[model samples]
Target chain A: MEYIQIANSTPMWIAAGVAIALVMFQALIFARKSYNTGKTIGMTDTQMKSAMKSAMITSVGPSLVILTGLLSLLVTVGGPMAWMRLSFIGSVMFELMAVGFGAEAVGVNLGAGDAMTQVAFASAVWTMILGSIGWIVFSTLTADKMASVQDRFLKGDTSLLKIIPVAAMLGSFGSLVSGHLVALNKNTVAAISGGLIMAIVVQLAEKKELKWLKEWGLAIALFGGMIVAAIL
Target chain B: MSDKRRVYEKDYLPYIVRYGKATGWLAVALSFGPAVVLAVIYGVLPPSAAVFAAFIAMASAVGINWFVEPISYFPIIGVAGTYLAFISGNISNLRIPAAAIAQKVAGVEPGTTEGNIVATLGMAVSVVINIAILTIGVFAGNSILVRLPEHILEAFDYLLPALFGAIFVQFALMRLKLAPIALGIALSLTLAVNAGWFNFLPGRPTYLITLGAVFGTIAIATSMHKREARRD
Candidate 1:
């Protein structure tokens, strides 16, 4: 069978499906555990439901972006491989590099139809898997220790504890937004518009006590900016 | 420590650690299993050396992030959230924002046990939403994607910048005075990189610029916060 056919084969689907299923199972287990723990820690049902709603709402725009990435990957690597990798543990940026390295290892260019063979595809799969292992290994080995490190850093200074996460978030987001802003393109436009929209929505939500605006602020800003950029 | 907080930790941390380790290891195995199955079926395993070479090449590019990201994000998401977010992937683009927004909506302070649980719940919800969307996109194939209008597809390119901008503003609102200073540093660094002022730096200078901006903002914000606390 041709390599492309093999890339989209039933066996590949089964393998990918199993991987994806395991992730879903893991999520389910963790969600249940966290929910029970939240209740024990005095979290109200309203808070839990609100958190779940906000999370779902916030995810829609990013998920659309991920789907766009998947579309590009599907054309390059076929459906099953792209689906499995993206759904399981891969991001758009990392998968592209790993797949490229895989193809390069077999002396082929990815997305070049006739160049990719079964052997090259296999090599690419191996490269993608191996390349990403460091993250999993490092995360698994140090996760507990890292938590301990954080605890030691706190030293029971509960008053200042809140600032740590908030500062981390501000710094992280500042860097990310500035990267986009400096592009001086539609990205710049989108980013500025999005930021402005969010600021307005949040201000309104707080002052007017418009609960729904707060809930949908991010989504509105994201899509609104995209629309503004497109129009411009 | 509050008795409730102590009990929650004593009772919950053990289960989280055990299950997190179990699932994390399982995820790693699952990640590699597909490639092994493909190799056996095709009987075309690439040279081990070649695979290693390709892995090294790819890892060299992104390996630093494997360590940096988990640590940088640990304070915001907590241990359980980190485990789930890292395993499930898409931390910056999706999980972190989801966790952050959920915590905000639930009025839970981050770095607290309640905050950890809420963040975990948010991440799990996002995983489910992300998986569901990817599943639909995969199963539907390009039929749906290809039908998207050209303008809409163009707009999708702006989604990420917009999302990041929205996220930045959400956090920036919390510390109005600090936001501009952080933004100024990030913008200046990005402009310097873009203008080729950092030509001496190796690889993409954007990363260095980003790190500078993040840490610089954190330092400035921390000092300002400290000064305010002292005055109070």
Candidate 2:
């Protein structure tokens, strides 16, 4: 009857599996739809496959990071919910913080021995759910609308409109990089090395028509950047 | 409208909108279900008041991110990706970078319809592969993590900066002039925020830095693009 037992229960695992299945189903359908749409719009199979390959490789390192985070969540919230949340709709940091807040509200501490009563478990669940509800609800309401709103502003030549996304990419990414740059830690070394390596690799890829190298460009930069930072 | 835009915006987008809204609500329901199921089984649902308190605490902590992240991210990921990314979570670390690499390998630009399609497909592949990795890790493969050396684990701390560095370089190389401006604006604002100059603001300083970088870079870059086109 322990709450932790319920957390790692067979029913919990079923729910987790079902939830992850839903996510995978949606992804499959979207991929199929996009692939078909791409064919109509002049995308070759090679290009689409290469994009998929690049994404798969780029995802491996970060996904491993998430997996490492999963180890922590396993101890805190048990395996099922942690697996479901990370697989479907939540990040490690948000879930961990919510669990902490929920535990505190009930005068119990998390990961501080077995103070997790049934109510404490429910409280944590409620906080995680309600906390993240805003995103799904907001997207339900606004995801469709935002794109058209963007399209409205970008009504001119579509070619010229390309600048909008490019600038947004730089701007969003610039903010991310700038944070590390100002921190002046190993992160600065990591970021600079990644950027510098990318600059060189890309120049070489284009100049020499290194298709294989170009395809693996970001993955190389990612690990290379980290190795440089680690050595420093 | 251009042929490409017309196909995406007119012919294809409505279908995405339909799928997005339908599945978005389903995701909300699925995500919220586990808490209720566990509570009902234990017959120890936290009292409504306690649940409300936990909800309030979480909302206050991350409420702004719920609204802001989707909007900021929509530009790069586009419509299908908006639904897919928000529903699946891990938007910044996994999804956006997945899209970026896919576009790079496929020789597509981020803003165009083609890039959007490529990004969507790439993200779909990433989620599938990511889930496969997590499934193994949770069930029987976290042995993979426990055996790693301490220094190797330390490398992951730099993963974010390294990934960001590479992505920023890609977009910056495309628009060399505007990249520095974005980095400068973001660094100043972020440093100012770090210095406690912006303590009065709501939510994380990241939003301020990102919004500043994105909007500021967009304004300058758009004008520069236009003027260059005019001369040409």
Candidate 3:
């Protein structure tokens, strides 16, 4: 479907340009804000750009590889190949954007905004997947050893794990609802709205301690599943 | 040595561990029967799309846990419940799990952990009903009802949007993020109006639409904030 288009016609130059623009945008904002606040880290723009370039180089490899794997499979088989590619790509980007939204949701719910503000938004999506895999592995294996890692990173606190489930729920919420939208024939809008809903809800749930987070998710799943089945 | 640190460390571990164990167990039990049901349907329904749908459902079920709020176990409930509803004719199959999911989304624990047990029992009962339906749907297939082509089945994707719209609207009203709520509506509407226009988006049209909607809303919100700031 769309994946084939991406794999074939997607100008790496264009994709690379957009990715670089995003990196520069982040660096500029960070630099300006830090300068205005007079809390100079003394790092030069050149250094920052160098670091950003290297980071993108490392991460884009995995992302593109994954993208190829996701898109290519659909074409090989010949069904709605475009749909599958698009869904997979949509899911990845949504996951990336959700970090900001997730942070907002958590902040609203727990008054954890200040802490969230300190979280580096750059490279966040990669960090999250990496972190989660790390946590899952650590938790499942040397549960106690992982405790030390948590303590070290969190400055001797590990209660963040309690919040892990909320984040996971948000991801699923975004993906499935977005999937539903894609299924329902409202592609782009569905992905964006679903992603936003997830981001904001997690924030709302985190701050206000809303109980319906679980409820709405279940409703979406069951009702959505029913609708899927009915149409099929 | 202080109580805060101790609470964050020792006492919290046992509770978190217990909760993790409980959730993990709930997840396994919820999916077991659904997997079996899908297998049966795979044999009987004989749609190529069934494989994709089943893969998505299972992936969404498990993958959702990684990204969304795991504090609530309703994904498990929904996963199990959907299969049960599919198997059984009972509408009640929709109720408890739906309620449970809704409750969690609201940020309230679903009455008690005891609700999980009740949900499981309800689902088990639905499975029995499903078996009965399977018998009827199979025997009555060609002689009893009309059939649609495979391509038309793809349109069922919209159910996700409808479900998300209904749920998110309710959630947004509660949280007071009227802006995002409005964005959700607008995005869904746009997709409905110009589905083909989104084809130009990079990966998937759905995702492009989503990104477009989110950023578009953000721009609008930013301007609104600027206006409010100027007024103040």
How would you class the docking of model 3? incorrect
> What lDDT does each candidate get?
0.81, 0.84, 0.33
lDDT of 2 by residue, B72-115 (tens): 77777888988898888887788888888888889988787898
Query: How would the candidate models be sorted by lDDT, starting from the highest?
Result: 2, 1, 3
Q: Give DockQ: model 2.
A: 0.75
Question: Please, what is the TM-score per model?
Answer: 0.95, 0.96, 0.28
Which residues of candidate 1, in runs, are more than 4 Å off? A111-114, B195-202
Question: By summed lDDT, which 10 consecutive residues of candidate 1 chain B come out lowest?
Answer: B201-210
User: lDDT at A159 for candidate 1?
Assistant: 61
Error of 3 at B22 (Å): 12
What share of the reference contacts is kept in model 3? 0.03
TM-score of 2: 0.96
**By TM-score, who's the top model here?**
2
Interface DockQ per candidate: 0.71, 0.75, 0.03
Over 4 Å off, model 3: A1-232, B1-136, B139-158, B178-232
lDDT by residue for model 2 (A1-232), tens = 8888888888778877887888898899899888988999888999998888888888998888888888778877788888888887679999999888887678677657647787788788878888887988887788888867886876755665678778888888998898899989999999999999999988999999887887788889989999999998
